[model samples]
Target: MTLSFQRIAYEALNVCNGVTMAALEAAVERTGLAPGAAAIDIGTGNAAVAVRLAERFGLRVTAIEFDPVMADLARQRIDAAGAGAEVTLAVAGAADVLARSAPVDLIVALGTTNVTGEGRPTPEAGFTALRRKLRPGGWLLWGDIVWLAEPPAPLRQITEATNLYTDDAGWRAAATGAGFEVITGRISDPAEFEAYPRDAVTAVRAWLEAHPDAPEAASIRFHADRVQAITDFGRDYIGFGVYLLRNPD
Candidate 1:
C-alpha cells in the first residue's frame, strides 16, 4: 500500500486509544447506558471502537463499516477478542446504516465521518442522522479531522480532497441542527498529532528498507511525501478532536 494510505489507516486505527477512545469511554460513562443498552459504531473500521464499547462498558454493539475489507478485519478482530457475542459487524456507510437502525442508546463515529461524502456534515447534520437511531438523551460520539492549517493546494489535492476542517463554533452549530446538546469536546493533543506522523514515517521507512524491491515500493516512496507534508502541517494545525453530543429531551 502507498505510505499515505497506510499512514491514514494506521492513524485511524491508533485513535482507538487516543481521543476517539477517550471520547467513546466518556460518552459511555456519561450516558450511563445500562449494561444491556444498545450502541452503534458508525464507520466502525476494524470495529475496534465497537468491541471496546462492549468489552469495556458492557453495551451491545453494532459496528458498521463501508469497506468490506475493514468490516471483515473488524469482524476478525472482534472474534479474536472474544467480543463476537457483544458486537455485530455490518458493511454499510454510516448515513445508510443509521437509516435502518432503530433507537439505541448511543451512536459513535470515529474517524469515519469524513468519508461519508456529505462534506463531513457539521455536527448538526451528524446529530440529525444519529438522533433518529438513538433514544432521548442518547449520546453521539464524533471524531473527525479538523483543519490544523489552511492546507496548501498541493497538499489538499494530494490528499484526494479527503481532509476536513472545522472549529468549535462550527461543530456546535451542527450539533444544534442535529438536535443535540454539545456536552464535551477537546482537540487532540499536539503530542498526538506529532506522534502519529512520526510513527507512520518510522513504520514506512522500516518497511522500505526491509523490502526495497517490493512491487509497491515506488508507490510507498511516492506517498512518503504526504507523510512529510502532514508532519510539517501538524507543526501548526491541530487536526483532530472528539465531540460528545447528547440528544435533548
Candidate 2:
C-alpha cells in the first residue's frame, strides 16, 4: 500500500499534531495533574505529550495512536525518554482503546477525536464519548482548532470538510453539554499558530529536496503545497486552544 501523505508529512516533521509544547505544559499545570495519576492520551501523535505527562508529572499514561508508523516512532521516543515503564503505547484508534481500558484520572485528546469512528462525530458526541473513559472528578485536557471569526461561506465549507472544529462559544457549549466544566483554557498565540504548519511545510520541503528520487516524493510535495496554502490563508480565521475540563463527581 502507498504511504499516506499525512503519515509521510508527520514523520518527516517529527510531529503529527499542531498543539505547541508550551501550550501542552500550560494545560498540564492548569489541570493540576498529580503524581501517580492514571492518564490516557488519545491520538498521541509522537507521544510527546504522553511522555511529558509520564516524566514531568509522574503520571502513568496510556498513549494511543492509530497510525502504525506514528505509533512506532512514539514507541521509540518513549523508550528513548526512558518512560517505557510509565507509558504504554497503544497502536489503535481512540474509541477502540477507550473501550477496553478502565476509567482513568485524566484523558488528553488533542485534535484527534475524528479517528474514533467512521463518520465525522459532532463535538458534543466526541467529547461525551471521551468523558465516558474518565473517572468522576477526573480531568480532560482537550485541544483543537476553533474559529476566530466567521469565515466566508466557501472558506467555511472547506474548513468544515476537514476540521472537526467550531467557534469558542460552540466548543464551550459542547463541553458543558458533554458534562464537563471548563476550568481553564489557553489559546495559541499568533506565533504558535503559525509555527505548526510553517514548520511542517519546511520539514516536508527539506525532505523533498533531499529525497528527490524517492517514490513518495510526488505525494509529499503535493501535501506540502496544500499545507502551505492553508497556512498562508486559513490561519487568519482559525485558532488552536487547549481547554482544561473537570468531570464533576
Best by lDDT: 2
Name the regions of candidate 1 deviating beyond 4 angstroms: 1-4, 7-23, 114-123, 148-160
* lDDT, residue 27, model 2: 69
lDDT of candidates 1 onward, in order: 0.69, 0.80
Candidate 2 structure quality by residue, lDDT tens digits, 57-88: 99999999888877877888898999999999
lDDT of 1: 0.69
Clashing pairs in 2: none
Q: Write the per-residue lDDT of candidate 1 for residues 119-173, one digit (tens) a residue.
A: 6454455557667777887888877666556666665564435544466667777
lDDT of 1 at 212: 89
Model 1 is weakest, by summed lDDT over 10 consecutive residues, at 1-10
Q: How far is 213's C-alpha from truth in model 2 (Å)?
A: 1.6
lDDT of 2 at 201: 79
